[model samples]
Target: LSYVDGFDITRHWGNKSSYHSANDFDMTRHWGHLSPYHPADSFGIQDIGIPSNCEVSQVHILHRHGQRFPTTAFNDGGNTQRFAYKESARWWASGFFDNSDGGSSSTSYDLLVIPEDGTENNTLVAHDSCRNSDDDIIRCFEDTTQGVFTNNYLKTVLARLSNYLDPKFNLTIMDVYAMQTICPYEVAYQGSSDFCRLFTEQEWIDFDYALSLRFYGNRSFGNPTGRVHDIGYVQELLARLQNQYIYVGNISVNSTLDNNPTTFPLGQPFYLDMTHDNIMVGVLSALGLNYFKGSPTGLPYNITHAPNPPENF
Candidate 1:
């Protein structure tokens, strides 16, 4: 058996026209960037050489998600001051403002009355311990919208892929695997808070619109802040993948037709694991080669190699 990762046909086309202005973005700029589309020869299939004896029984394509919205929050001066002094002080000290004196204590923003030791602090504090200022929360909502857009874009890409595969193979019953941890990490203001409320209807609408823009336009929200950890999850995934391969390999080798062998003849049969750049790096770490290096050409692991042979048959 032989393996050839499905070629990425869209890389040379650049982002959709709706995503950029004519002057700013150019598809040709990426013409020779060493993507799957940039074959050394005239024929695109020349890049992926198929072995003569081996058959393409299966193809596992693990691809990165499409371009994402910026995840970074734009904290202007007003937002900074509002969070640092006002929200922080109110949350930390539990003190009320002077205006809530006459209103019902439960719904009021008054912070003067401290709850007794046994008294439930639920009313005074937020439901989620992680809270950010109004602006920050709005920004986060916007960022989340981008994630939603990414999902939709992925669906579109998959639909196109399905169409492309329909003629060549029976893709109707192909199994698709998506990572469960495929979500944007939340951006919290301080370590103490976990959730922020988008109080106004306009704020909610704006967030949805921002997400739409990110999906349709390919504008990034910027990078996320705060700690993002994936160590345990990654380890679990790796362990499962290894166990699955081991079991499958053992079954194949022990079958009545096969002789005992040290290694699986064509290597363990498996499909691609769809994941993010972060997860790819995590998997690579266990496989060694942890040092930082430049991008991947046609070569794997940043190592240079001769181009694959052209199709002889």
Candidate 2:
């Protein structure tokens, strides 16, 4: 985390986190779920367009819901929901479809119908996405981060703030991270916040990596229940692609909905389903997209390197 040198005046920025394994990127566009919609081109696929000889057929499009407030206070509903109804099609949202976009649509149906990427897990998840128990991966990640993984960064940050912070306030390392996270939210709420310039660019990158590390263990493939979250969606996709009524009991997949032809149509031009960002990660894991699983720069969640950041980083 370097300084802005206090010389440049045009929106000079110092940061302690970056969004993704991006290049000389200036803005923080890699803040994981909180980040703006960026391409998943990290896969390094050469040809993205459809082949000249092959025409577009059925397309299964899965994406996260629009920008919403943090799930802490309110549900993640946003103004972007209305736009989904701009097209003429039957609308179906997942189970946790609490946010209603005026219940308006271009289709004959008065309200959005059917189940989609909403919180539609009506059944009980065996693992239930990892509880906050001490044995959970989250606890493991937290323990590692606060210990050998990043003791140096935390200690250094704590040391750096010893003189400036008021003696009345005792801020711990977690509090320091909370301070770092506030910058993005503050910028989003208003136009800006001085908090954005608190840290240098390298610090921003380190924080982002820390976050990625946490997500890797708790939300993504590192957790036992990670891929299972999207297993239902993958089964539905396969049913549509194969044009069959394949029914299998799953942790989250609704059998009644899948069996009904009216609800689960096999043939369609394109299907759009909205889901949580974590579920999409599960989908990637379910599909075995190894491209997102690693990188030459020692990314893809090789946590073995975390304890030795100086050597690998």
* Candidate 2 RMSD computed on C-alpha atoms after optimal superposition onto the true structure: 8.2
Q: How accurate is candidate 1 locally (lDDT)?
A: 0.27
TM-scores of the models, in the order given: 0.22, 0.67
Identify the candidate with maximal TM-score: 2
Model 2, 193-298: lDDT tens digits are: 5665666556665666666655555444555555555676788788889887657646666677677777676777667665555566667777876554544332
For model 2, state the Cα shift of residue 118 in Å: 11
Candidate 1, residue 74: the lDDT equals 50
